[model samples]
Target: MDDLRTIIDKTLKQYLNAKQTPFKDNQLANYFRREPKQYIESYIKKTGFHFNYDVKSSVGNGRWAIIPWIVLFDTDISNSATNGIYIAYLFAEDMSKVYLSLMQGWTYYYNEFGTKIGQIKINAALNYWRNSLNLTSSTFSTQDIHLIDPSKRYDTSLPRGYELGNIMSIKYDAGQLPTNQKMEDDLSLMIQSLEELKSKLISTKDIDLSNKYVLSRTNIIKNHKRTPTKRDYDQQS
Candidate 1:
């Protein structure tokens, strides 16, 4: 737990010290992608719970350029390899919103050079999620179709829209319970805080640091020279 706190503190500090550049958003996205598995693992450890979660991403143009979706399930008690508790589903309009909410202290760093590096990271993450879910569909459906009546195979009364191209999915095993709970709680809190901060930023139209909350504590190591102490699985059990 102490190590997890230290890692988060260090990450947050790096985020704060990072210069606010046009492409900082892209940088931030890359930062998370580089250590995604580790980050998620730490989150699980801290939460002291396990769960299964899926994430997906797709790209387009304008506001619809990037989309990310996530679904979470609780770990199954009977089978560690399969089954989980149903958690929540999340859908983000773009990578920026996804990062701002899920990854604290790492937003707007990848918006550099009018490039879509952040979008690429999102797609990669989505791919990871899809692989985890073992989805058979090579291409996702672009239309939203539903039948009004369960007895009828098709419904004529409902309005049908083409499936939006960007979509992804994931599944979790029961063995991942503790860590999953921690991640979910942390992510949920971060999202709520980010929403409030975003609303304030929009209202004030300010980009100054003074206006933002000090979400991270200072004192980050200048040199990335620390070795993480490994936990003993046998001892833990």
Candidate 2:
């Protein structure tokens, strides 16, 4: 895992430098630099110094995008007969970024734990953690959950083959964090709309009906029918 993380971090640095858009805020960058100070503080408080953390940068978008950092902790605390926090980080630039980062994080965890027992344990833990963070969602379909599991075939191990079912069966509560899946979905829609607009602009040689509603409502003098208004041309300009 450490080797994989190092390779990813190196790739990210090269990608960012190639784009010439390093993050603007050094402090924010450092907040995600390795085991973040904030996460360390929280872990210390929760488990009373028995736990330690390992941090790594996972993914990043272009200059205007958010980056994710993963944090894995060793905990002496036990929940459901398993030992320690075993937490993973999905730190990002905002709520929307956090949502995508978490999806990526779950993908990584699922890949790492490929066995039935491992899958059962990790799925339950993930559901509990999300709920504890107040990150439960009605929007997460079974298809979405299946996407995260590398072994697409479901057995008795994963319960209803969704996070909520795993958590409910285990009877564990984590609490709420924050949810931004809706915002992420909305942003995706906006990007798609923009791409469509751009395609239309490229394909059309003339602007004919731009602001047609307003032009149709305007009164024209004389008995002749009005010509198409100049606003169409102006829109092209």
Identify the candidate with maximal TM-score.
2
Clashes of 2: 10
Q: Which residue window of length 10 is worst by lDDT in model 2?
A: 165-174
Residues 136-164, model 1: lDDT tens digits? 33222212212122344433211111111
Superposed Cα deviation of residue 199, candidate 1 (Å): 37
Judge candidate 1 at residue 1 and give its lDDT. Answer: 27
- Total residue pair clashes for candidate 1: 33
In model 1, which runs have C-alpha deviations exceeding 4 angstroms? 1-29, 50-65, 69-91, 94-237
Q: For candidate 2, give the lDDT.
A: 0.31
10 residues in a row with least lDDT, candidate 1 = 156-165
